[model samples]
Target: MAVASDKTTWTIALVGNPNTGKSTLFGALSGVAQKVGNYPGVTVEKKVGEVVHDGRRWLLVDLPGTYSLAPRSPDEMVTVDVLLGRQSDVAPPDVVVCVASAGNLSRNLYLVGQALELGRPVVVALTMNDLAEAEGTKVDAEGLSRSLGVPVVPIQARRGEGLEALKDAVESAGAAPPPTVPQVFPEPFRNEVDRLADVLNGRQLPRYLIERLLLDVGAHIEDRIGLAEPDRLQLRARIDEARKRLAEVGCKTPDVETTARYAWIARATEGVVTHAGETGSRFADRLDSVLTHKLWGSLILAAVMLLTFSAVFSWATVPMDWIDAGFEALGGLVEGALPEGPVRDLLVGGIIGGVGAVVIFLPQILILIGLLTILEECGYLARAAYLMDRIMVRVGLSGRSFIPLLSSFACAIPGVMATRVIENRRDRLTTILIAPLMSCSARLPVYTLMIGAFIPARAYLGGWLQLQGLTLLAMYLVGVVVAALAALILKRTFLRSATPVFLMEMPAYQWPSPIVVVRRMLDRGWDFLYNAGTIIFAVSVVMWGLLYYPRLSHEDLAPMVADRERAEARLEAAKAANDDAAAADAEDAVAAAENHIAGAQQRQSLLGRAGRLIEPLVKPLGWDWRIGSAALASFPAREVVVSTLGVIFDVGEDVEDEGEGRLSQALQSATWPDSGKPLFTIPVALSVMVFFALCAQCVSTLAVIWRETGSWTWPALSFAYMTALAYVGAFLTYQIGTWLGA
Candidate 1:
């Protein structure tokens, strides 16, 4: 047996249609330890892992799952670039492991055939053999291998069956001669491709890319072809002529490829696959009927979402509270241990208070991601998207927009990047524009802070419903409602286009892999924590300085200091005499004098001055300078609003006996300077949450928009429109709520 041409390391690329146990096979091969990050210059995630077998290292690169090799968008083009070894940092695979579903051989083999045409060594790993057998279709691996002149191995990745044999087959195939390349285009179309290849002599386009170039209409692959201005015009003319000739011969450019491929597949699989049982699982069929039904499915989806949101509030409450208390104690410890200076303030006010505010919401973010992973694993997410398509279509979108929008609930950055899957430019831009309005995890801290503080924990319906959870749910719904309306208007006006037809392949329902779910949840959680430690940490430190700097002059502070000193003297005298009543009064007086100086110093800080300048603009939203300043400080990342609030309220330095809920307590006790009324009313909290909910406050999301759109115009437009909408929304919310005596 030849072992990959004597190379020390073999690159094995795993290509497959989705839901074919590709990821499962990857886990078994690489021990579920994969390095994940974005591919160079693209948003598509690159998942690669490695294993040492027989003293030879094999790098397993798991490509994204797709039905075809056609390159329509940048993300799809990434698949082609990797196969041809054009993607940076990824070596050409010695052998391509095309993971095919055993039961769905014909459809699964479609991508396998495409991979074969790439002129690389190809090995078919037939997965879901048990599912195939259950459906009464038995595939003879030897017979199929012989038919295609390639090795085929039937394996159950979940049970780890035939994995060793499959690995051996990959080794053998890598050293074996390349399999016969499958031709999917007709004779006339092939002639056109040949002619076009010769015409582009200056360009080193791959044979596979040439075929796709002629077949893929209105795709992004032309850029990958890299034709010069003159060459592009000449290439377009030649392509059009070739397409015309093929059309005259009744061989269409695109559909001809599909038709010819299936014809070849029909002959290749002859007498090899047998069916004895029903086509599919009866239980799954019946389950989908209820789950995908219009009326019942919609209700179930609503219930599922409500339960998910409810879990975020209920399940994450204890952990969040614990984290909050832990940070509070740490801050207090740092304060007492260090001297009163910038260094001590930096640790307590900047690090602990600022970063801790956002870190406290990690539990809720993790729970949400984990549950979404479960729903997606169990295959309900696809069905939910199918259900939402009806509403989406009315807004000039299809079910294809649902996944990206749903992803926004976790984080808008990924959600905005995911629009590459949609080929339509107008629809993609429209989706990206409305994506940040989906109330991503970045907004969760603001919502939790407001809802947990102001919304009463009243129970209804025999304790099934809680006011706080409902309030959280409403904030999310507000974002969704606004996104839908915005999408509708964008499609009708700026990004006007018809809703593209959505064709989805529903994956079989199965138990979610614990490894995948936990890894994903932890990955997202770590991202959250890492950001808190880095960008949010830096922002927090800067905010602390803005609030703490420009100390009161001696002339300005002498009177307040004297008052505090006098109160301290009285406290010492009363305590020495063991007069408990007088001691209590003196303690109150001392606290009052200290808080007064703290307030006076804050009013004179840099941030406070800026806040006062914008106070008039936001007064209609029931906000004072302090709230306006926090919003201004948090423009970089919406979650930083929590950190800003923590610094503003002197969270860890609350009244001596007040322990947990430090920020909330400070807000409740905060009052206007001129009037002693509370600063944060129910209406004010609602206004803040609603504003954060609707705002385009994340700088990262805007940058991604610029990258995806290849223009600064869209991001600028997004920021401008969303900011105005937020202000108006917040103003109305506060003004109306106050009128209703909220």
Candidate 2:
């Protein structure tokens, strides 16, 4: 039978606890018919997918996963608001599908009980039946259906089992009258709830929401209704009296709802769920014993992170090389096709170069996201939070902050977005502020380049450890240490708040779904390309204009150009006469003449003048004008610093050529104009790397921070404080190193 009711589409809400396979079912049901956007007025993502079956269309709204509907944060508030139809943008669901894990039925059924209380037609889709069977537990689907007086279907969403039957159950439930589940609360609580329900009924609020407001302390219902101070206080006073009366009857009002809900669930599942004793030491538990141990787990986590970072550098190199060559070839083709002019230079140097600098990091980003997704899908990431909880708590953050900070190692944008899991406002904001100090993949290029050029490749510990790799590792460690210290300082000073208790449910380990991992990687990659890529591209073009503008006069360039041509002519003449030595000499002269002209052009450009102006400020860090200009130009994206240096040194900004050690060679050979001595000494290289490691050079990161925090103040503070720290850090590093004669 159809539940269309003459309408073309029926709205269905999919509700579930976290890690309940709800998203997997949604993906399998909707396939390619899904769209994602933020809920109106909130940054929490809203996913809606459509499925057409049996001449009826169902719009499935996937709500955020939460253990309960009580609102604690903005993100959690969205779940309650949508279920109660308080959100103006979304309609009330015709049928509610409560996805429950068959293995974890009791805890999962707590959410189902709330769903039933919403007075919507409900169908229970039991997922993870196989997991339950494997764990020596069995769920009686028929008994559950009879006990709850609702349709129950055991379905394997990942394996596509019983999906059609589940769909049929949904349509049947949607058309049937809403179920009348008996009230579970005591008589006193019921009276209070009924009284509140009547008042809410007069105001057009749902009975379910009213009951929630009566039960949930500090719920946002008053704010949602825009209750004035007098009425709000009066209603709150009534609720307190009701709660006190309930407490006087030997019932704790604060936890009464939860206790009664679980009691109801136990009765509903009595004789339905069969288990062989307590779940004793499953493989996940056994593994957790080693992986979550204090000493061994910490070491394992460190090793996993080390491997992750190492893979980011080593695995991404091949794809990065391909991207670099592709851009290089494209630039060369454009240079050949177009005549020499501003238009050609703008296309090749400004647009292509700028965009390429950002694009080249895409492979590394994809790899990191893919790996992290695997860790999440297989359920180890939750354990990571568990392992880091003690250390995170010491710094006045919840264990939830650990994931976002860990994610910052890949990129701070996603890392900041990950803070949505943290419900406390101060904890989330503190995490956002310190996230950039985690030293993301953007700093990898700078570290690798500087370390390779300056730090010798000699091995230590009997040739087991390479000095350069250790230096790279040190940079990352420094970032982590600084981030922890910054979090501590902010928690104690500016962003102070009582540390909230951290609670998390660890999902059982399972083989990661390839489809889920790939889909997530694509989502993150597209997000970066669409949002951050545009900003970086525009910034790059602006920097190019700054460096290319106010063209030098022909007379100013004429003498050097003439010298190069004359030297080239001499080389050709010598080659024609078969004079190899003379030809070599002429070639050297030509290269010298070209460098002279390039130097003159760079010094005279607008960017050059600005760099010269800032050089005095940076001289204490042992930087010359070129170094200062490159550093300034890299503000939009840190990877551009290498390309900017290539350009500044008269070498073409080709990623492939730069990787071939040309940029390093140029830096090594660079000398101060006034002193004519080497400029890029060991101390200077260390200073530069240290600065990049600590500086807030990424506009994309700042944009994401602003978006996540809903203000410019945090982003501005992040930029200012990081930049100041970088400057001081580099200044002390260089000054101290110079004094030590290193």
Candidate 3:
């Protein structure tokens, strides 16, 4: 390895397998001081944090977790390229710190073995030692260090234990000579690698990387190296000859390397590690008996999901209400302080109302994310995935895909971000395409409103279930079913590929640290607010402008003003006569007249015209121009539908008072202009709910999809397919319901 000569400021690369507490160590070492950005050409997160210890400064780069240096995906390719010093943006690390789990030593060391081949000084930070002791496994750190020819430090990153020692060890490695570990390959294979390396004619490539290129079939290193056409053909011929000779010697290229590496590791750890003989079941194994049970585990997973959703709805209700009222009071203050003009209107409607609509959902978002973090930290998420693997595999996905899809229940943006854990590109892309169909929390408001207004409060199963609650649950299930079918279809057609192997390590269950969970929640919340929230805010402003522009002139309200004047005069006359009933009737008439004028003005706005233009297309689904207008306004956010309907119905866009029946009352009492028949029936309400449940209404979801995929093609395809499915689903429901009633 080419180490930095100056060594004033060392660059240390932290590498490890997933779930080894590598991130926890990074956090403990760096605290809150870090910078996050995307890699130069890939969307994978690149985190660089600083560590100042003992008057020495270290720049630590936390690389993505990978099982091996073989580049199967862009994420792994980045990890390999950076460690190989091929990435131009980053300097090669002065020393490598491989964090390993004491409990899963053998598997963790597989990665460490690969790191040793990179020629950099390697230091092992062994974690989870306490858990290993509990499982009757003892690792002698000194002996293991001697065997591996490196310094090993035991650390409990969560508690900030052994971090100082780890730092010292890292510093020591930086000052030492670069390790020259010989290859573990058999003589025949080593000879083949030597021949291949010699063919390159003194190229600047490292010997280990050249060996990797020969072993990793169809690796990207060939493309990255930029070899001439003639040299590439010659290199290919040499690699084929090497493999043929190795096969004649009763050895396979890839399998032989894996066997040789493991054999060497076994010999190195033979006397250094000791295990209790055939002990009784440990806590994890015992817990897995029930948690990973096929039938009971599925039920447990369902109950967990139910509890999470229930908490999001129940616990967040109070905070959501508080936020709504606060914004409403602010809007009222703006109205009361300013005169009746366009400036006041824009502040009240565009800024406060539009922004508040998105902000009110923050409580639910935080609650959902916080709960998921706790579950993940406690390691129950892995068991949940294991339980769902059987079902997911049928749809061309592994158990790993379930976590991301489940996260979609809270929001599709984070769900898309969570797909980075899936190593296979085809699986990850397929998951991203269908994630939004999981019916996120944004659709909850629309679902609750429609069901409350239409579905009766009758109970079933001895009051254990209510008809309205069942309808809400059924809407969520519909999304789940549709998303599964869509995934199967996509895998079978558009993104078809062989199913990659799925292997997940189940860490021992432990109590999650509040600090860690809270930090993670805050990180995700900030990411959402920064990346997706900006797009939501901009879209909200555009929608507000569309609804606010083309204001009706004072002359246009002359007739309604005269009608209000007549009602007021009647009210005054009745009051003077002390006729309470007559005065009440006159008051109602005045309010109705004012509401009519407001609705008329809204109908003349730009958004209103666009809604009318699309009314014909939506008419078959039992939606009138007003409902269409609300739907169109909610394109930026699903929860905006309630506020949009309130605005269109002249209810003042404050729909938080559901008990007072403001927006629902308006919808129920509404009538068609031509037939004078009630517009919102049970069938119409069900159709609208179905459409919202399946439609791609949230622009935040689309933005995240674009960011994750690094292209617009997938997001565009997602929007098109989902919107089409929603229309068709709603159309069929409306037509069938109307026919049944007839």
Candidate 4:
């Protein structure tokens, strides 16, 4: 008679514990069409994706995977808040799908049992059926379904099986009348919960769901009915007596609801599942032997990292060269077509040159993401974390802190957000403070220019090694070692205390799917372009304005230049008329005089006065004021450094014709006015690269870190430390190297 009346739309929340294939299922169901956003103001990742099944549409909300919804951290509280709809901002779900890994059903059931008692239309999706089969375990899906009063669907999401069955079950559950919310405890224990609830009512605590659960477990009564020394002795006797009574009735004292939930699950599992044979899969054994060993584990991790860096360095160059050539040609075309006026300078010299410098690093970003995807999907990443735990523990960092720190190597924002994985508040905060200290790929362009120009390509140690590449490698290693030592010192002095133990679930090794790896790589590339590109583009335009003003007009310089050039013919005749080249010398002197006269005319231009004003302070840094001015102008975007140098050296015309390819020529001819020495010597170049590597010079990184940390203090500290470290490090490198006659 009910006829499953037409509720075609279903609201499904995918709930599961951590490392339970929940995200994998979400990605599989949603494809690339999912939208990932934040939960209101918090950085907890929220994913909403849609799917159409059997002509019925379903909206899925992927909640953060947690071991239990105990509200331990802000991220963990998000799960409880969403489920209870207490946030006022988020909508409550119509149906709940609890995802469980069949391999670890006992631990996974802990979350599912809580969801079931919430009285929502629930379905349990058992994942990793293939792994279950290999373990010789056969779950009686129907029997388990009947026993729990909910449908149990066993499926391998990776293989795309049982999806139709899952959809049908979800549809049926949605059409059915909503089930009554079940009481979590049995009769006798229910009485104790009510007594505890009475005590909480008198205290006038907030009616949050977690507070209710805590009260139901007697924590509220303990706090309210405080006892002095003599009263405590009497209360302890009563508490022990009550515990004996609870055990007599097959109940537990400390956490009655938790004890009841586990007991129910244990009873439901009896005779419904079977364990087959031994689990000696040769591949797994061999992997564990090598990856879990103390010595070889770290060695393998080092080798994998070295290979990844090598790929990023070598493979990225081909596309980088292509991009470089295209920009150069475009700049030439813009200059040639726009008639050498102010308009041409803005488009060719200002905008194109400025933005092109930033865009050239895209190839490196893509390659790094691609390789990292492979490492993660193949499951070596988890093993790497386990192996590094030994070293991390010694440095006062948990093994879980490794992922957050490692993610910072790409960017600090995501890495800071990833600190949610570190459940310990102190450890998470410490990791966030040091994340920016890692040298991100944003520093790659600066390093490449210096290393390529100054570091010789010749080999050392009798031709057995390449000296140039090794120097570049050493720079990367310096960042890592420095970061580790900084973290150690911070934990010891400022946040000194006991370290939290690290716990992680390592997935079994498997051959990675190509589609998933590519999908992940493309996602990271898109994130970088959208997040970093906009900031860099705006900064480039601003830097261009600072360098482009005060252009010399052809008409304004005619009176002064015409007087000087009129004597050029007499000087040439003097040169031709001389017997021993004395006349030639006179003509050369006349040409030099006319050029000097023209330069004096330019000295009155707006840019000339600005350069002269800053000359005093910059002289000590081995930078004649012109180089100092360019450095100041290039602050918004580092790639503008070369172009600004071109403008200040009076080679702007040549660079506009050939693009950045002319940077070497421009720098070679630049000289300090006071000392007449080359401005960019080996020491200066190395010092400049070190500064870029250490500073939070990019505005985008600053903005993202601010948003992620939800405070100006952390991002400000990040910027201050990095900039101070950069300046001091660079100052020492330059002074010592030049003093040692480098």
Top of the candidates by TM-score: 1
Clashing pairs in 1: 136-277
lDDT tens digits, residues 1-742, model 2? 2344666688888989989999999998999799988887777778999999789999999998888877776767888788777788888788889999988899998888888887778899999887777777899999999999889999988778989999999888887778886687877788878877766565787777677777777656677777889988887887788778878886666688888998999899999999864353276678899989999999988777656655655677688778767777887889889997878877787666656645666776788778878988888888888998888888998788988888897788778877887877888999998899887777766776677568776765665456665677678888877788889999999789988888888886788888888887897788657633566566656766777777789988888889999999999999999999999999989977876776677788888999999999999999998889989988877777865665565333332335644456667777786677998988899899889888999898999888888899999999999999899989998999999998
Task: Give one digit per residue, the lDDT tens place, for model 4 in 1-742.
Answer: 1323375665578899876778878878878769878898687888888988788767788998887755656676777667755555556666788998877787788788777655568889998767666656677888878777888998767677887788788887877865555455677666644544464465443333423343234333343345466754654455555556766887765477577778888877787877876463555667788988888887777767766655565677678667767777787787788786667866765566655654566787688777877788677888888887887788799888888877877776677788887766668877887776666665665666566556665655564445555655566666666677777987898767677788888775566767777777777667655534565555545545554545457786666576556556566666566644666665665655554543454354444556567767555455565666655665554445544554444332443323233444456555554455677887887777766666666565677667766778867877788777777767777888799888
Give candidate 4 regions above 4 Å deviation: 1-9, 54-56, 131-147, 155-162, 178-188, 197-212, 215-262, 271-274, 278-282, 456-473, 531-533, 552-683, 698-711, 735-742
Write model 1 residue lDDT over 1-742, tens digit each, in one string.
2346689899999989878889889988898567988888877878899988788899899988788889887766788889988988898889999999987899988888899999899999998777677667889889999988899998977667899999988888888888878666667878888898898766888888888878878845777766688978877888888889899999977889889999988988999998886756777788899999989988888888877877787888789778888888898889999998889888887779888888988999999889999998878898998998999999999989998998898899889988888988999999999999999888988998888778887877776667887888899999989989999999999799988999888877677878778877998899889889998999988888998888899999999999999999999999999999999999989988988898888878999889999999999999999999999988899998898988888775744233337787778888887787888999999999999999999999999899888899999999999999999999999999999999
Distance (Å) between predicted and true CA of 718, model 2?
2.4
Per-residue lDDT over 1-742 for candidate 3, one digit per residue giving the tens place of the 0 to 100 score: 4555456788889999888898988898898999988788767778899998667788899998877777766778888878877777778888889999988898888888888888888999999888787788889999999889989999999998999899988888888787768467888988887787777757877877788877877746787678889987888788888888999997787888789889988987999788873242365677899889988888888767666655655566588667767777888888889998767766777666655655666676687778878998898988887877887888999878887898897788768887987867899999999889988867876876677667776665665556666677678888988988998998999789777666788877777878898897787567545533465556555666677678788898898889999999999999999999999999988877876776677678898899889999999999998889888877877877766665555433444445434456668877775686889988899899999989999887898899888899999999999999999999988899898982
Candidates sorted by lDDT, descending order?
1, 2, 3, 4
**Candidate 3 TM-score, C-alpha based:** 0.89
Candidate 3 regions exceeding 4 Å error are 1-5, 277-281, 403-429, 440-475, 494-500, 527-533, 634-686, 698-714, 733-742
**Which runs in model 1 stand beyond 4 Å of their true positions?**
1-3, 31-43, 130-138, 155-163, 183-192, 195-204, 219-223, 228-241, 566-586, 654-660
| TM-scores, all models, native as reference | 0.93, 0.90, 0.89, 0.80
Of models 2 and 3, which has the larger lDDT? 2
- Top candidate on lDDT is 1
Report per-prediction Cα RMSD to one decimal: 2.8, 3.5, 3.5, 6.3
The lDDT per prediction is 0.87, 0.81, 0.80, 0.67
